[model samples]
Target: MGFLQQKNSADDSIVARIATLVLRLILVVAIPLIAFAVLYAGFIFLRDGNAPKWVITAVAIIWGVGGVAALFWIFNWIVELFSDTWRARLQPFVFVGPALAILAWYLAIPVGRTFYISLFDRDGPGTGQFIGLANYATVFTDRLMREAFRNNIFLWIIFAVPLTVGFGLLVAVLADRSRFERTAKALIFLPMAISFVGAGVIWNFIYVVRPPDTEQIGLLNAIIVNLGGTPRFWPAHTAIAPWNNLFLVIIVAWLQSGYAMVLFSAAIKGVPVEILEAARVDGASEIEVFFKIMIPTILGTIITVTTTVVIFTLKIFDVVWVMTGGQFGTGVIATQFYRQSFIARNAGLGAAIAIVLLIAVIPVMIYNLRQFREQEAF
Candidate 1:
């Protein structure tokens, strides 16, 4: 009787363990389906519902914020069901999965699709014939494209970068010594709050031209006329050609200087005061101290600022679009892409132009990324 009882007890324990495992497997599949289905329904409602705008917006905000939290909570609960070793390993990936999926959908997929589209004509193979590399060839061979490359690579990069960086460094150095540093920095940084399009519009009044006898409405023309100079078309003067590109770029400098100033100021402040004192004690002039000590100390920040501006200049569109609409030799790569894509309706060519811009930016991006990794390693 004792032997029979022992065997029965061991069988019962095994049966219970098997039951728990089966239940867990079922829940792992069922819980996610239920949760995901509910989320999908909310998405459908948001997409197709005829609800009031405010109602939809409120729902969207709640759903976006709460839904993500709930999903995380649910996944976290699921993770708890696993053994300790597996749970620790899986949790990080579980949380990061959603973000990675989003980036793949939004960024990676589009780039791949754009590359595919670039290989064909205006339309895909459904209507437009396949023309491999023809669009890309046009990008290099076209006169307008060459001019745009010149403006963006040679002119804008050369001129706009130095003006913004130098002016910012100068301001940062000066402002550090000033009594009302905060107020002055705020005023200089204020222009960035305005939209790029708005900045373009504001500057338009400053550059507008009228007949010499007419009231000079433009700020520049008004000043020029008041000083006995003639009112000339500032932005649209194609006779002078690419010089007008520099004029447009000066506006970018004015807007971006504050950004550079803030970074430079932070970097400059971080330099050891002892070093500056030592240089001064050694009979070095203020200029020598700045060039020898201050510059080398903040050299990293300068490179960061330069690369950032280069990226911005490569993708520059809003100001140019608003100011001249790429007319009269002001077309950069971005403007040319816009003109080809939308206005000219040459989709393949436009995509090619965009890819070219992407290619131009990638080297700068790689350099910055490598710098970031090096910093992290350090």
Candidate 2:
């Protein structure tokens, strides 16, 4: 009975503390707002056919600065004084509540809306009707959409994985502790610092075309012409344009290679030197040591790097968007989503594409998390 009474007393104390803190918070916010309202009302009442301009200016200055000061003072006072254990628990919500609300309002709500719209046959406007799997069906069945999806899959399988992993591994191995490591890394990482749109524009200049009779201005065309090959319209030719997409992929690879290198180099260094010396005593070739020893040791890191690149590849949009605008068969999923939703005004189709992207990303993310957890286990 005594213990029960103690528990009841504690609950009542917590409730009272909560009530007091809430009242303090209300007063903190309300005082400045009420003052501003009262001052504005007085300003309105005292307006006798435009009294002296200085008087009006003084009133405005007083209310504006005074309101801000009062708000700052009250908020700080509440944070300093009323922030006991109950208030501390509530205080974080005070700060984070608006951000959480805004995130739900903007990001979470839109993502949910996109998923909902994927189920309907809506363009940018009214929902024409419920069309369960029709939009997803059209995404696969429609020629351009199908081609875009194929190209996106190709980007991930053919380009994104190799460029980010193979080249990154190669560079990391080559540049590790080399004389020009810092300079090499800086040059490689420079492209990543450029915005996607900016990198696309730079590559656009490289892939520029001139008439056959005209002097080639594009670097690639100029090189080809100087080598006695015909100067072709690089961006226009569908046959060659997909390979040109690889060139854009190169820019991204160049930027991301440094990141991969930094990670792998750290992993490589973590390999016990004793293991390398033991392999050397066994007469393993340097190449064999790298392939059999270093790589096996860093398999987890390699998988982590590869999966990270895969996610980026799945979402590759800006480069493709800026350079090709989903034209010449260089479309990836993200760009396709934008093209469908905004350009084609097909929200349903766009949402389907987004869902496909989400599906693709989720597994890769899960794999990445698993790899990291396994590495931690090791």
- For candidate 2, the clash count comes to 0
Every model's Cα RMSD, please?
Answer: 8.1, 8.2
Most lDDT-accurate candidate: 1
Which whole-number lDDT from 0 to 100 does residue 10 have in model 1? 36
Runs of candidate 1 exceeding 4 Å displacement: 1-56, 82-86, 372-378
lDDT measured at residue 116 in model 1 versus the true structure, 0 to 100: 79
Most accurate candidate by TM-score:
1
Cα deviation in Å at residue 200, candidate 1?
Answer: 1.3
Per-residue alpha-carbon lDDT of candidate 2 for residues 115-163, written as tens digits (9 for 90 to 100): 7889877553364567888888887888877777676667555776777
Task: Note the Cα lDDT for every prediction shown.
Answer: 0.85, 0.74
What lDDT score goes with residue 320 in model 2?
75
Candidate 1 positional error at 88, Å: 4.0
